[model samples]
Target: MPGSTDEPTEPTPGKPSAADRAARVAAMRRTERARARRRRALVVAIPTVVVLGAAATVTAVLVNRPEPPSLDAVTTYEYAGGDHVSETVTYAENPPVGGQHDPVWLNCGVYDAPVRNENAVHSMEHGAVWITYRPDLPAEQVEELESAVAGETYTVLSPYPDLPSPVVLSAWNNQLAVESAADPRIDAFLAKFVQGAQTPEPGALCSNGVGTPTG
Candidate 1:
């Protein structure tokens, strides 16, 4: 059929359709949303990692901390407190952990001469630990005993005429006999017995009492 001039329709070059523009806008929105979610997740993860790291450090410290050494060789005793006597009294233990004692307590320090049993026992009531060595102990060993208790208070060191062992450390209700001044138990006994749990009269005066200390 003959007709006026007509042509097929074609899309213009270098231009997008309305549907293509709408799809690109939707894709940009999805990408921006994904980035926003990643930023939020990163914010939450940073604090969580930091908290976990701090907790791990604290746990390691607790697990690695050392425990106190055990004191097993020390000998324990049981005695009542505050039994004062004016006359000389016999004791079950040679140094007397605790028993009838003079009202006056022997002052605490080293003594070249022998300390009276009654007075020393009184000092023990006041949380004093007495270390006695046999008179025949070597001068060097005696010096070692003194060194072991250096910078310490409430300790009595004296020479005993006849000791069952070379050295004897006696507290209120505890005692340890060591053959040498170098014995490790000496320090342990002092640590546990000076104003220790066994003290019958904890915090009593070791000074301002009877018999001046030689040292």
Candidate 2:
């Protein structure tokens, strides 16, 4: 046959050329790399956000929490008896500040009944804050008083039949009397007087004392 100049035929319509296949694979790899990077970024970012959120929550709690009462308004009294006494004694204040007290310390807990005066006075010498409410006080107020003393290492809650005020917070040489059990001053008194500077005996035990647990 006579020769004429002619171009080669193309491959099948659906078949890709080698160069096109290579380009497409490279593009797919780029897309995959991009997606992988995004996944990793999310993995790192999620925990960071959670941690930040938790920190913010904790900060808000600390900021919003109520502060304890102040002790500046508490009245100071003088008493002489750093020593323990086995005999009955009388205190100038209805709830003795510091005077003859039982040899043992009263346990730290809520009390439904009145505690012995002499023993309680002894606990004051050992750096305990005695919180006494009138026996006739409303149960709700008593609960509030109990809340004040709960979980405190050097604090006691009890009922006094004839407390001058509805509630009296007594530490060694210091006394604060409030007519309300929910008085903010009660917290203040405990904050300052529990293991306070006025304590005649610091680091004395509040538990394992002579008194039985009052339910």
Per-prediction TM-score to the true structure, in the order listed? 0.70, 0.65
Off by over 4 Å in 2: 1-70
Local accuracy by lDDT, each model: 0.74, 0.69
**What value of lDDT does candidate 1 attain over all alpha carbons?**
0.74
lDDT of 2 by residue, 85-200 (tens): 78777767788888777787777667788888887887888888888888889986776666555556677788888778888888998888888965656655665567766878
User: Model 2, residue 101: what's the lDDT?
Assistant: 77
Question: How many pairs of residues collide in each model?
Answer: 0, 0
RMSD of each: 34.5, 29.8
lDDT of 1 at 92: 84
What ranges in model 1 sit over 4 Å off? 1-60, 63-70
Identify the leading candidate in terms of lDDT.
Answer: 1
Writing each residue's lDDT as its tens digit, candidate 1 over 6-83 gives: 778675564444344334434443433444466332222122234655653212211122222245666788789888
